[model samples]
Target: MAYTVGEMARRLGVPASTIRYYDKEGLLPFVGRSSGGIRVFTEKDFEWLRIIECLKKTGMSLKDIREYIELAMQGDETIARRLALFRKQRTVLETRMAELQQTMDTLDYKCWFYETAAAHGSTEGISDLPDEALPEALRPVRERLRAAAEAETEEV
Candidate 1:
């Protein structure tokens, strides 16, 4: 069944203005108009919106997204291009995830370090604690952070 722009926005969990903006930006080329010029959406349109949302979440700019959508509208001949775009996006996400994981690991080590210091009532000897004294999971994180700090100091 068809849906009004408001209904589509509600179903997609976005504001109607966002849908209107997408249309205005040429991202919703497949959307139709009612007799009164109101935007009309269908189930197929939801699939397009979902793709747009996915790409947006992947840090795709509006211009890039519009290009992707245009390529998609061109059908089978653009399959290879689309696949390349997706693969590039996947690589970008993987790199970002790895960086975020490293950051999280560093934060975990900091939390443990501070907790240990608090327990001992001072940080005087915390830095000198042996790796064996750290939780097994955090030992590597601490080592990596220490190495990074040392590298920075050497660079200075």
Candidate 2:
């Protein structure tokens, strides 16, 4: 069924402007237009938009997406290249998810330590924290934040 841009937006739960922007960006090749120049989308077009949304959510830049579309426009000749791009994105996403999970685990450990220390009235010195204390990944982030705060205070 043919749907207006607004209808497609409502159906996809995205803003109409986003759909229009995608059309303008050549991300939607089959988007139709009415005599009055309003975008008229079809079910197939919405399906393609859903794919575009999924790609965007995977952190694909518009330029990369455009490149992928261009490759797609070339038919099956670039299938290998397209697969390589998707595989690379998948690998990167997996790495990031692992890192985030590690950080979360470290934060949870730190929270447990704090709870235990607070409950035990051990407010003496924090230097006795276990040698394995904070995860190496989080130490740099905390250091950077502390540095930024110190710099901000100096700026004030």
Candidate 3:
């Protein structure tokens, strides 16, 4: 079913101005216009919008997104190019996820550290505690943090 730009924006959970901005940026080439020249979106357009949102989440620039859209408009010949783009994006996202996981691990270790210290009423000797004193899952994180601190100390 055809939907007006406002209807499409509401359904997509974006502002109407965002939909208009996407159209202005040439990202909504698949969108049609009504007899009165108002933007009209179809179900297929919703699918495209979802893809655009996915790419945006991957930190893709609007220029790259526009290129991807243009390549998509070129039909089966661009299939390989699209696959390469997605593969590259997947790798980038994987690296980001790994880094975020490491950060979360560090945060988890810190939470445990502070909670333990708070229970003891002092941070004294906490950092010097044996690895066996830490939760098994946090042992590696503690080691990593220690190694990082040692490296910084040596650098200074």
Best TM-score among the predictions, by candidate number:
3
- Per residue, candidate 2 scores C-alpha lDDT tens digits across 16-64 of 9998898788887667788998778888887888888988988888887
lDDT of 3 by residue, 1-156 (tens): 999888888988989998899889999998898988988889999999989988989988889889899999999999999889888889989999999999999999999999999999999999999989999999999989989999999999
Query: Which regions in candidate 1 have their CA more than 4 angstroms from the true location?
Result: none
* Candidate 2 TM-score to native: 0.72
Error of 2 at 96 (Å): 1.6
- 1 or 3, which is superior by TM-score? 3
Ranking by lDDT: 3, 1, 2
Candidates' TM-scores?
Answer: 0.90, 0.72, 0.94
Q: What's the CA RMSD for each of the models?
A: 1.6, 5.7, 1.3
Clash list (residue pairs), candidate 2: none
Q: CA lDDT of each candidate?
A: 0.91, 0.78, 0.92
Model 3: pairs clashing at backbone N, Cα or C within 3 Å = none
lDDT of prediction 1: 0.91
